[model samples]
Target: MTPKRLHLILLAFATTSWVRADLATNLVAYWDFEGTADNHSSASGGAAYHGTLVGNAAVTGGTALAGTGSLVLDGDGDYLDVATIVDVNQAWTASAWYRPDLAPAGTARMMVFETSGNNSFAISFGLRESGNPASTNHQTVVDTTPTNDLFGNRDIADTLTAETWNHVALAFTPATATVAGSVVTYINGLVSQTLVIPAGSTLIIPDSGFHVGTYRNADGRWFDGSIDEVAIWNRTLSRNDVTELYERGAASLGLTADLAAAGKAFVSVESSDPALGETFGTGLYDLNESVLIEAVPKDGSLFTGWSAPFGAEPDFFNLTVTASVTLTAGFAQDTADPDADGLTNYQEIVLYFTDPDLADTDSDQISDGDEVLESLTNPLVSQLNAVNWIAANLGGGTEPGDIVLTRDSGTNTLSFKLKIDSSETLQSWGPLLPAATSSSGVAAGLIAVSFPPPWVDKGFFRVVGEAP
Candidate 1:
């Protein structure tokens, strides 16, 4: 039979939580040194803590580490009296990006916080030169109490590169009754050193003004360099947080451009959830954070793979974002038969109008492909639904016609023989002859028989016998 024979005239039709984390969680004050250089702490609801430039301490353009400008200190007397006062008795963190023009000097102060009268310094952190520009050490002096204080230094000479931008951060955790207070320093996103406070000491820095580019009280210990993106937090920063901060700042300066030039680009796979036809691994991610991305295909689609720059990466993969790059998840449209049924996705969706994702559209123990291609049954209507066998003549009188026979409920286990007799008059019928055609399944609970051609003046048809 031609494919059209199977297409018999008998027709029937029917119709992250992913979330990105905020990096500015407890930020108290931030000075990006762009424009007029007001406090950029709005993200954390901190005080304005505006900086008043002194001497030649001006926001210099085109010499920034991350943004458009940086605060330049002329080493002589230039400084910034940042009206910042915070409770340093608890946990805190301070970070900054600096590009020094000369090697570290013994008395060169980058940041200092002191009492209003400046009787003594509460905290002072800066660089100490060791006669060698390449062997600089970072120092911090903390006044834990009126009668207690501590001063120490950590050798960051290995990471010190004069005239180049570098990141420095110090985080503190207050001491408990049984534990000593500790200070952790990070250089370029790595742990440089940790200093433990005396067990009985507690940070006693009061609400005093903070200074940048010079020691408190406008002392001659002025910083000679460009400083950008200086920030302070009332809460301690974790290792990941510090790393993210450093990487984000470095990326903004395009430090990863060399890596990208070496044929490596940050890769991030994007897709929708299977239900929404999207991918997984949704949330805000740090530039240095490695993430696991997965491709999930929505209904009527398939995940082919990832796009270029990610050759041969599987549907689920891990990636570290060191630079700014966008990745695309590849997907094949709903034209494939993933279920491996006899029908293509297009045939199931467009022609047969069945679900392509399911091998069986109806829970009747028969797959959609078999129901349509084999039994010529409707895949959507379950065979369990009761349906009485019925017959109907589509046309009459010398016209091409169809005899439709419907199947009974439950199963197609019965067979029948049809016969016909023709006569000039209704009183006497001619010898019985087999019907023009035998019964064939048309759809679920339905079948049809087509008359070949030529017709007499009258005719009669009947089911002669049945086989169970």
Candidate 2:
């Protein structure tokens, strides 16, 4: 008779859920000061700078929203002329991470996209003081002449504290004949305020260019602060989209990966402290922490090359997590059998840790040949879902050893028993691994047997099979 065969081929997947968060498809420019002084960033085509850099304004590292850098404007007329001819009249969003170094002693125009000819129809933020740098707290500033009582409508309630990184996203849409929110401002993923742009005002696209760390005209007050992750969108973003931007950062866009094997690997993430990092998935590490992402391969196979700066070991690897990362791990089968136990190398690595050199790894007085080849135990099989059989083989760990149990393929519902802790004999088995049921699967087929992201560390598993 022929022996039964099972194959293991686990892979990582990014569903459509990953694409809906990023709203960068309509972004006109994104400036993340990673390297170079001016005109160095190409996130939005090229030459992200067209104006001049005044005083000692320079590019600095550390404390950035996306990359590991930011631009410091020294309040001394130091600013970057991002776009040489600002052409935004309606439906636009201006977003950036701002850390104010000085409070405005007087009314300061921190950043703006206003028409050179008409100043009322614009989007900006600044300290509402009326003199030199004053209180360290500022407010969200704006002015839609056609709407705000013929003057700029600055938010008196939403005050900004100096010397703190605040994610600011200001969006504007010309008021229509129908009732709708025209101007909206988001600070740290929360809506700060909304101003109604008058429908009667003329929506004018500025002729000069939008300014960063300063207003458009030369007379505009020089903003003294560190700026990072400045992004300009042609379309105003929804509140949900703005929240996603603040939460995911550049990851708002689908995480880019340099994976090798498409469907032969997976990356699981566990964030005991989300304040430091919370990213998940294979080839996708956007969090900040030390991590151990097991590169589980198919049965009788192993990872080819885990080529990423994080770590490069096979099934087990370590990484000092930083910002976003691009990773890929290769996979291939290992048919070499030095043990001559008829068990391949791939089976020993993934199915369970067994000495590739010794046919009797546990030295239980039984060779692997008698235990598996004859007893039909511990065969490497693909992850079968809860639907196929009541029970099946488990690719588990070593020690007290796991018993196999299974029913016919026609049965859809099944139950099993678990020995409390590590009970070698069935006489004392009781309780469960951790809870009443060690785990439960609610999905159809093999998809229901996956462990949660937090369970990727290391543990034991039991094998399942049909009764003789």
Which candidate tops lDDT?
1
Candidate 1's C-alpha runs over 4 A off are 1-18, 37-47, 103-119, 130-132, 153-159, 253-468
Encode model 1's per-residue lDDT on 197-311: one tens digit a residue: 7676776654556777776677666677788887888899876567667866776632222334443333334553333346655433556677887777755567776655564
All candidates: TM-score: 0.49, 0.46
Report every candidate's CA lDDT. 0.62, 0.53
Give the TM-score comparing model 1 with the true structure, all chains together: 0.49
User: What C-alpha root-mean-square deviation, in Å, does candidate 1 show against the real structure?
Assistant: 22.8
